[model samples]
Target: MNSSWNPTHGWEDLVSAALVGTDRRPLPSGAATPEAELFDHAALLTVRARAGQTPREGRPLEAAPQERQPEVSRAAGDRLARILGGERPRLLTEWLQAAAARGHRLSPHLLPELLDQAARDRSIRPHLGVLAGARGRWLAGLNPAWGFLLEEVTAPGAAHETWELGTSGDRKAHLGAVRAADPARARHLLEETWEKETPQDRAAFLEILADGLSLDDEPFLENALDDRRREVRHEAADLLTRLPGSRLALRMAERAAACLHTENGELHIAPPLACDAAMERDGVRAKPPRGTGERSWWLQQIVARAPLEIWPRLFGRPPGELVRMKIPDWGREVMAGWVRATVLQGDPEWARVLFAWDPLADLLAVLPRKDREDVAAGFVRRHGLDGQLIMVLGGAAAPWGPDLALAVLEKILQVSGTQPWNLSELSRLAGERIDPALYGMAERLSPEPPIQEVAALLRFRDDMLKELQ
Candidate 1:
């Protein structure tokens, strides 16, 4: 036998013998290794080894440095809690903006939740950086989930290096930061890597340009119209259309002018015979949907892309006056295309006038919130409680002003029994959008199924809004 012994090997042998049983495999030969003595010896050895064990030491944790900025007041902290708890979450943006404006730092305990919120709602990331301050950035560095906050907090001067060296997401965020500070620099940065970027990346980066978009970007955007990717070309065209004076818009205006002309007091339209290369290069798709004819599709694109001002210029009248005029056969098509263009360009005057004529949901959503509610109220008085009007009203801001809420209430009470199907969705909308102060009026309605349901929803929303306060 070897004189030097290994404790591990000895333990292994003892364990193997114990597992096989001393009855089947006899114990090792010796007075000290007797079957009855074997267990006692093993137990002694195990106790000695265990007692001798010592844990390895690790580095000590450092205390977090104190923040120099003052913490938000308890009232403000409670408000943030309500906002993050899903009570009127849309107000979170407003709250953060206000807090940032005041230079108020969040309570350190709230940093994790705010960082988590920033991760989920990327739209709030920029605002979060200011509120979260230095400590929040430190915490973000320790966790991958909160890593996105880093880019939003990075200084503009350091952004260039990060843009060149970071991952795709980092580069995009850096681009947005640079864009806000300097639009021209943002465009140049994108141009530097334009040829190297993938088609998908190029398309995504082009969309960020819309934030600070101006006439200065028209040349680069106009050149992007010939990109190999259809999405890239479409994005470029869309941005160019927002600039009414761009050459692309001029091209579209010229095409539309040719297709539509005023003869006598009426409008005459001859849709295009073919989608020529020049038209396609200007972002008109040659292929139409399966059910639509090429000519109608071409006409819609031309009208939609051309500047809304082009119409008044061509017809020598304001949009409202021209829209009131009768076209022989294509009035609906022409008006619909113009509505789409008005929405795309976000022309509030055109949207306001068009809403008077059509009261469409898309058009209503584009108007300023107060204007939207006011317009809906006018429409409710004019048209009464119809399904279409209710749908349009749903697009306005919530907790609607007294005039609009009262109009909606009156309409609901009038049409309660007649249209149960429409009432279901309208009841839900009422609950979400009606002013909480009107809950008493809503509650007084008879406990009929639809009325009761609407009342319950309204009361619930009222309570929810109250909690936020």
Candidate 2:
């Protein structure tokens, strides 16, 4: 090639020669053919183009903030690395909770991966904040993808700043923080911006209000029943219904009393004939979804939103007595409404009676943890491992105590012979929730692969928990 076939000039000539025929634009000297010469020069110019750029200075990065909380034990850190590396990753949440409870910080090198994992699985976000420490906060400050870590762990003062100026998610997080500290203050903050916020935001803020709900919040929520947005009105009514003394609750009680009453040891029913303006204003829908009769829908809503206390008073009997007694005509609708009310009111006595009437997972959630385990154990002993069983187990909190754990193990062994396929979800829950001390017992339960898998996870979790301790 010619001496002028340098990095800059050489690229220009190669492009011109290749585009227009070499006959019109003569090839630079070197190779025998124009094609050969063009290829050789192009290769040379590509390398020169890539390697010839002048380097520029980069801004200095600040060091990560100092962590006040001490790091987790070396063994615990190694286990965390393994969990993040994808060995029984579901245990990551357990590990995070354990570490946080121990008042330890996460190893700095592991923050990025854990943060990434948390971004995908939001259930872990709550545990991640305290354990992540100052360094994790620093990393979150640098990377917008992990910004949720900052929001989850923001200080009370910083929360107010975020509420004043941050994005929608940030504002919500701020409001949650304020609500936890002072429900009244949070309500006032929302009230100040009530008119300025969008309908969606109004609904979201109302949901936050549910955490520290009181009779004090009844007035604000009652007014919200007239919101232009359906969702905002719905949320307001839900909050009101939970407060049995609220005016909306009293109205619902009166409406429900009109529809449902008992006479001569048999329950009578009178479903609403029409959806009037008064009923609609109290947050009842004018229309029903497919397959549900409009009158039945109205009756269900009225019963569900009415105070649970109304039942015992009307029947002159305890919840246990009422739950066992069948509704003669509207059995499905009335029982379903009572279940909804039981959940909303969070009455343990009602939940216990309801669970006995029908072993439901939603009702299971309302029971205390010990009671939950006892109820689940009783159900497992009677019922076979099935979809509903899985849901029931899910409602109870983990490290499911010895009675429930052994009951589940016995069921696993029993089912292994006849219906092994059903063991998939049951075995997984057993491994995740069973107390780790039972690893040996679990291992010796059966030779089935599913049984063995549960044993292995139990052992792994045993070691994991010890390392944290």
Best by TM-score: 2
- Per-candidate TM equals 0.62, 0.74
Once superposed on the true structure, which residue ranges of model 1 sit more than 4 Å away at CA?
1-174, 397-399, 417-421, 434-469
Error of 1 at 319 (Å): 1.2
Tens digits of lDDT, candidate 1, 310-412? 8887889998888888799767768878988888798989998888888898898888888888888888877856678767976787768778876776667
Q: Give each model's whole-structure lDDT.
A: 0.76, 0.83
Report, for all candidates in order, the number of backbone clashes: 0, 0
Candidate 1 global lDDT: 0.76
Please list the Cα RMSD from the true structure of every candidate, rounded to 1 decimal place. Answer: 11.6, 7.8
Clashing pairs in 1: none
